[model samples]
Target: MKQSQPRYIMVGGFLGAGKTTAILKLAEHLKRQGRAVGLITNDQGTGLVDTAMARASDFPVEEISGGCFCCRFNSLVDATRKLTATTRPDVLIAEPVGSCTDLMATVTLPMKQLYGENYRIAPLSVLVDPIRAMRVLGLGGGRQFAPKVTYIYRKQLEEANLLVVNKCELLDATQTAKLVAALKQNFPKADVFAVSARTGDGLAAWFDRILTGELSATDIMDVDYITYGVGEAMLGWLNATARLSGSPVDGNELLLRIGCALRDRLAKADAEIAHLKMTLTATGDGLDIAVANLVRTDAVPELSFRLAEPFTEGELTVNLRAQAEPALLERIVREVAGECGAALGSLASFKPGQPNPTHRVDAGGVEHRPVLP
Candidate 1:
């Protein structure tokens, strides 16, 4: 028996934009209303902190690893097929690679033109951290990404059907107004919204739109592939899974220690941090997550979540993105694992190469092969 085509709600943004947190909020909202939800997480590598975080929330997750959706379109569809075979969720919430843009041409178009019979593509939403918005919009001063990297980030905003200013709590009414005005002035076409996914400040309206609003064709932003590749190469990407055992250490504390150590290492390298997030899930009843982010070179690392207790054994997933050399990032990861008493497992650390879209078809019948860098 064939079930009805489910809805695909994609949430996109640049690094440190809080896309995962917003997706979790939307999932929880949908679940509360008796709607079955399935999640899809994409990354350049495996052992994704986002994947682990979704599973920690107890949602069924399908991870499209090794590449972004544009490069792994077939795998994304296959994951959806597998989820349909099992969970058959009414809504499929997906988070694409933060560094990716042009989804209207790549991901959603393929989903609609080919799988129109199986999936309803929702409006394209792009999230932005308030602090990031200020820096990107030139409304405030802070250490920022290089010119090429900022180009990719700007393209992400330029292509948004809905531009969501996440982490609104950090901004007061006046500051929020200023940022909103700046975003509107820049991307006048996109409908701007402000919300705090953590505090539930203004998510209902966004959720309602995603649930019932219509989705139409979007403008494909002009992107220079060479520049995009350069921007991506400027950032070192690291993903790893480690085993933690012996004398139960506070999962939160251990993660904090590891993150602090890594932050110090990156700082010494004179690297500008983008985002460093980790999640630890013990074999017992729950999971703990610790995320430290340094948006710029001269910024302090801020922990988003801290563990409450200790755990004996579990799996830990760590993901780091920064403007630095991949070799240095890889070395710091190894040293951090050793110094923090973690038994390392499968690990991947490298700079993201140019995203070569394997499929750019509007209608169905296109087979996409994963392009590994």
Candidate 2:
């Protein structure tokens, strides 16, 4: 008989929750163990930051754009097959859209119930950004989401087989303990861990658990189609590309400045940032230069992407989100590039385009159509 195919492991999280970073850490760990790895990335639009990040590792990266893995299930399976054929990886790592949830019903359950023979579906792992979690759970003084956004976020946690508290490096022991306790209370069945993908802290434990088959099917939530529809309808996404050349500044610094500038501009324009993320990769090193995230513009930004060393030459890829018009996003990119160039004493070029949405739903039936410029 053919050797058992590699297990399918998925890392899911809300927007700006460090899924890409965590996935990268896990990929490295698995590779060190002499296991071949394949990666699949899903997003609502093309030119995704996660795809770029994954490809930077020289892994076989397949992207399913224009929708989540759930709605674009065929694309996901096809991408998996392509990765399997191309890399023959011992393990597959798939990162779904951060804004998405209900993986059990959409991806995991289907994989287990239908494609059980070809692949062993590992437990679905969900990552949460501590700051975002605090804000969403109303523990922080951040703006409260109108019922719809709140519903979507809660549903994301409900279906997780493993709930990971990412970016725990920012928290103290007491804070970490509180978050862990909260997660336990909320998701009693799921294994909860505090990890910092950037620093490689607590990752070994997580890696061990994931590799040791510690997860099982249990107590997955029943998703409400209507609420899910409303949750999706209320969000807006933007993906854009920019060209930059500056005095050899750290790539991480460039990303941080650019992300902050755009985020501030959007905030001034009265936009609520659901997630604003940007990735800069050096062409020479073939590695990520910088990555930054802002779950809300009013909140302090988080650095999700970083480099151990700096790069002098590379282009920047940005994915920004706000409860505002697409044109505004384009404008913000243009303005931020100019600002970044001025600071670096170099010319920055920006090319903005409409984000091609892969998934669109109006569960509230409010007919709140997004206006594009």
Question: What is the overall TM-score of model 1 with all chains considered together?
Answer: 0.91
Clashing pairs in 1: 114-364
lDDT of 2 by residue, 61-93 (tens): 999887778778878889989988888888888
Q: Write the per-residue lDDT of candidate 1 for residues 192-247, one digit (tens) a residue.
A: 99999889988998888887776776545566778878888898898888888889
**In candidate 1, how many Å is residue 29 off?**
0.5
Which lDDT values do the candidates have, in the order given?
0.82, 0.73
Error of 2 at 169 (Å): 1.8
Backbone clashes, each candidate: 1, 1
In model 2, pairs of residues that clash are 66-358
Using TM-score, give the best candidate's number.
1
**Which portions of model 1 miss their true places by more than 4 Å?**
1-3, 284-308, 361-373
Superposed model 2: Cα runs more than 4 Å off: 1-3, 246-252, 282-285, 299-314, 338-373
TM-score of each predicted structure versus truth: 0.91, 0.83
